[model samples]
Target: MEDQTPTRKNNSYCKRKIVTVLTATLTDVAQQTRAAAQDLAGLSTDLKNQALESIAQALEAATPKILEANAKDCQRAQESGLATALYARLKLDATKLAGAIAGVRSVASLTDPVGSIQLHRELDTGLELKRVSCPLGVLGVIFEARPDAVMQISALAIKSGNGVLLKGGQEAIHSCQALVEAIQTGLAASTVAPEAVALLTSREETLELLNLDQYVNLIIPRGSNSFVRFVQENTRIPVLGHAEGICHLYIDQQANIAQSVDVAVDSKIQYPAACNALETLLVHKDIASDYLPKAVKALQNQGVELRGDAAVRDVIEMDSATDTDWATEYSDLVLSIKVVDGLEDAIAHINTYGSGHTDAIMTTDDQAAATFCSRVDAAGVFHNCSTRFADGFRYGFGAEVGISTQRMPPRGPVGLEGLVTYKYLLQGQGHIVATYAGEDAQSFTHRDL
Candidate 1:
């Protein structure tokens, strides 16, 4: 009890001082990564691929260390009463680590997007114009739970000729550190600077990182709806990610019951922790009597807890769903079911409550499938398939930065193509823009080159 007032003040002062130091260190790292990104953007495809291969090998070599670190994280998360869904995402076993390593190797085999000419033309004689793809500089990625995201994002960043600063959830700190250390160690053996890829361990760094608009070109946040929205609202940097993933699957009257049941079961239970997993199941009223009982049995057998509307409840026994249930992104084993009058009603329900991430229609009717594909305003619209198919790797992109739901170019699972921007290049023999000026300007040729 002696001098307790002064001790509290001293503790507050220490906290502020530590935060200040961390902020300063983060700024220095951003500057260094910006500089390193410039060097990376100029490297040839072969060189970049070599670097990725090295990283993959390094990750493979460090598998034991990575697994041990992940075990510690899992233990801590378990002891702290972390959500089961999040714990699933946080766990990185040998199989998952091997898959991540394989993904890195796959990224190395992709066609490098840098320097590809999108447009080539001649404005006039000896004046050639070309629009070429280039790197988008440094990316600041903030993700939760998924430590495997560290490896995927780093490989994608390096392959796309961009630098990245990764901020993983505190739950996966040890795993992230182990992964990034191996990545940097691999980069040390390659031409790419290890600084091009870094990990920021503290939550304080995430807030400070958003303020680094000067160095970070984009901020990709992958987490809960509220967390993603917070990142979007706080950052001046352009955000590229979806806030929620309230994906839906509609069963039409013309749907093959066996196929629809399989798709629905797979979508909900295959990997419930994934963002693309089905959350809301809409059934055509005409098919509800025929399909609901079987689908409910299949889903329940797999441990899916369903909350259904009145119409769905009449067919099968389950909990009642509220209006809020329609809009929820239950990245877990929970699902909500509704029975719609027809295709129009199904589409309306989806458009109203869906997160615009991924939605699918299970039907053999070609016309209905085509209509659903065109009318649904989602990043991914599938016919007779599971929403989980809406993935970057499954789309043959090797890996993804994250899924973007904004009504913009980089919507859906963002791959290397989404990471690059284009620049215009004009070549001339001492030519000036004044030559194309008004009045006596020479008639110019706009021929394709």
Candidate 2:
């Protein structure tokens, strides 16, 4: 028993053990997920309802643990000299924890979209065509320090009958780990495969997960512009998210002056650090002399730094903003102001420099509002409301995985409905395709849904 093994041999044995463990984990996860997918596809409405109820219960019960883990993340972030805005994002108190739980319950309440037939048609005598909603298999989500996003995405993925692999920021590792534990426990209780919901434990593991394209179907990155860009360029998987939110608020010449001022102030100062918060303010030149100074003064009173163009500076004494200012997404208590010639200039400026995220136009004229709403290349175009309303929750979507600005199917807040995709099913009884290949083939009628 006292015989000593060589150090090199012992090291090799340890490495082998780790490799064996990782291999076994992945294998088991794959098997469980495959089983889960099959079961989900065959799930009755009753079983799905029961699973959702169990998930809601689990989220509610895990509140205390969630709060404790969030406290640790907040303390660490504060000690590590993280930016105040970032720290706020990482911190989650009781209210946010409750809201997260509510979000899970909200997903449970939404109608199950899986198996819902979107379209149906007949190709030939014995062939029938149908298009039904189905899960996207496995979704890999890489996100920053927002612990609640984990719960929201997990609920949506499960409700949509898809597997999820989450890679959260290291800053909120403890919180994310705790949340994952709760989710797994819920899955076990509901007889759902726990492996269907996996969380990466380390940054290196995240990189490895990103490369697991064979296992992952879609990649959704929700974080800073740099992080999103890095994921997009590094991975071949299709990404479903946006890089930035350079939202703008424009005040037209025909705008109600009082409403314009209120909307501008509220949009910029209500929650300056959020993506939907206004970063730039464009005012019509005809009314700039009367409105620019007033708006600047109101923002300054709220501690917002007003950086303006030459015309704006002439109206109000503020920092001279450069061309770069128009393109910046200063997620802070700062704003860029530019005075435009008219509606055309305003539209041109937003389309050229905006992030295609969210923009608003304040105008009293019906045609002006219609033109602004139709022309702006943004996910959301508001008429009189503040840009801050560009949120899934605010738009009545229960919860959102992220706000997408891509010119694709999901161009706005991605909620439970966004997690599902469509598949076409063709049922034929001894119908040969060769019969339809001739020049005098029977014409197929295409009916609209």
Candidate 3:
């Protein structure tokens, strides 16, 4: 306790200097990524595919190192009392790593999303207008505890002709560094520049990354509701991502009891840590007595904790669910159950409490399924299926950067199609605007070529 004032002041000054240096470094990296992305936007599909293949091979070669780094991260997270769901996402085993690599190769095989013509029209003689697809330039992707995203995003960015600046959560820093290193190594061996993908490991870098609107074309955040909301509030760049995963599954009276039970269980327990995992169960009142018991038994056998409303509790014994349960995204093996009078009531409950992520209806009745699929205001509305199926890879897009619950064009699992924007390319043989604005202008033909 001997006069610590000078030491504290010196430490504060050093911290300020370190932060300034980190900020400068982040800006430099953003500039490099921006320049690389401009070049990437014009690469041929063949060259892009070659780069993806090389990246896949590089990931395969670095499996051991990546796995070791992930293990270190998992251990550190556990010691620091990280959340169970995040810990689950942080632990990257061999199978997961291998699958991630395979996904990179799959992306290479899919059709390139760049330069596809969406429209071809002739405004007049020798005047042509073409709308062509193009990359969205540089993407700033900030995610938590999913190191394998490095591989997926890298592959997609290269294939779609965009650069990416990845900012992974602190818990997975080691894993992310290892993955990005391998990806850059792979890029160095191919036509693509290694700078096309960059990683920001420090927590302070996130705010700096968000401020780089001039360089980053879009920001995609993946994490908890509060974290995503924070990014959205603080960033000037357009953000594309969901804040919560309060998804639900409704079992209609016409649903096959066995099939409904299986789908319900799978949706909840298959991968509870995922954003599309079922958080609530809205069972039709008529089928509650018959379906709830079986569903509850199956879920309980798999170590799932059940919470029930009054009607649900009357059918099966479980913990009582409070009003807050309906809106919660329990990214764990815990589910809330509610009993509804019919299909309409179930839909109402989902629309009221759901997170607009993915909601499903289990029913054999075509009309009921149709109604639910049409009316549910979620990114994905499934009929008689597990919510887990709402994924980019499952939909044959190879892999996803993230799932978007926004009410725009990319309003689901965002894959290659979601990563691109379109540009209108017009060609003219010395055509002038005055030609179309004159009093004696000739009647020009507006025709599709």
Candidate 4:
């Protein structure tokens, strides 16, 4: 079959027109954002409260339109013969739609991070220093077929006082466009700019938008490793997101066998297609004789294809696992198994091959739990819990833009706080630097909040 994917050259003028629309749209959004930030900063608590309430209601009102748009995307996805996994991610029903609306309301209930003072200090005779949290300006988010991501990021950006530009997968274009329209309608009624949230209409437009680093303060790519890497390589703007989640569940020697089995099963098979879901199982050598067989059998019963190392295959009936299996994120009913000497070996294996998204340790010993949490170089290290719990809504953050594996300001789930940056606010009474330069300078005392 001939490829039907749209290209820039196919419709050069249309692509150019979309870029122009984005530029003009974002320019106006930026101006309004600047003004909104100032106004929101100066507003009384009562007014801010009122705005939040209105936002919640507006999102509630837009639910039916959101669902209708998502239905079209779902229909197209089914017709295109897309992979089952991709189709599942692209499909949105009543539950997901309601969750999206609830996510916006949850964000509205959270304390606004804008204008909140983070740090303060006195540098000299009269120069006062303060670091205040502020919007990160225009945020550009490139993501895959999940339509809820559109609502999650939009609400977070608005609450944090920042503008956003979204580029979703072409498969979900109709759904995304519908979601954006609802957001625009909501913003129109409020003090926020309608263009504060814009969506890319086509893939060609997205490629051009990726290069607009000067206009966008940050670029957050949320999808598969290949897509994220592509965006990272092509864009000059600082990209924040995880490449993959080759997460692990380490069944330590000190673990309770039943509890370990439960955690391991839940982490891998409960929701295998998510980034935080377990991809590998590491069992301690001391417990491998008994633990490995039981865990492997349970996983197999759940329709998981278990690929094991030499030690693991020797103990459990499993197919041979290749070297690449150890470094892969199956994101399906597939798992890799390895036998470790102890905690040291497990930690080393994870640090070397794991994607640092989320990893877990099943142990009864407190000291072992502490060691596992400290040594595992992952965004989330869980003890006695499933790696699947490494989600924004689960963490009580309302919603998330994506799970960031980068070791930066937003390491774990990128939520409302992740959408903001800090600005240094200095207050002074016209004191000159010349006064504090001499030998007899006054000592400064900084007060902590």
On lDDT, the leading prediction is 1
The TM-score between candidate 2 and the true structure equals 0.89
Model 3 residue pairs with clashes: none
Q: Give the residue spans of candidate 2 off by over 4 A.
A: 1-35, 437-449
Question: How many collisions between residues are there in candidate 2?
Answer: 0
Winner of 2 and 4 under lDDT = 2
Error of 2 at 213 (Å): 1.5
Residue-by-residue lDDT tens digits, candidate 3, 265-305: 99999999999999999988888888888999999999999
State every prediction's TM-score relative to the real structure.
0.94, 0.89, 0.94, 0.88
lDDT of 2 by residue, 427-448 (tens): 8888776767789776665444
Residue pairs with backbone atoms closer than 3 Å in model 2 (clashes): none
Off by over 4 Å in 3: 1-24
> Mind giving the per-residue lDDT tens digits that candidate 4 earns over 1-449?
11212245222433211212344443344454445554544544445445555556766787787678888888877888866656767788888787778777888778887777888777754667889988787788887777888888888877777777787888888888777777777766776656667777666656666667667778888777777777787778888977788999999999999889888889988878788888999999999998877787788899989899999888877889888998998878899999999999999999999898998999988999999899889899999889999999999898898889988768999887888788897778876667656798655555443
Clashes of each: 0, 0, 0, 0
Question: Which 10 consecutive residues of model 3 have the lowest summed lDDT?
Answer: 1-10
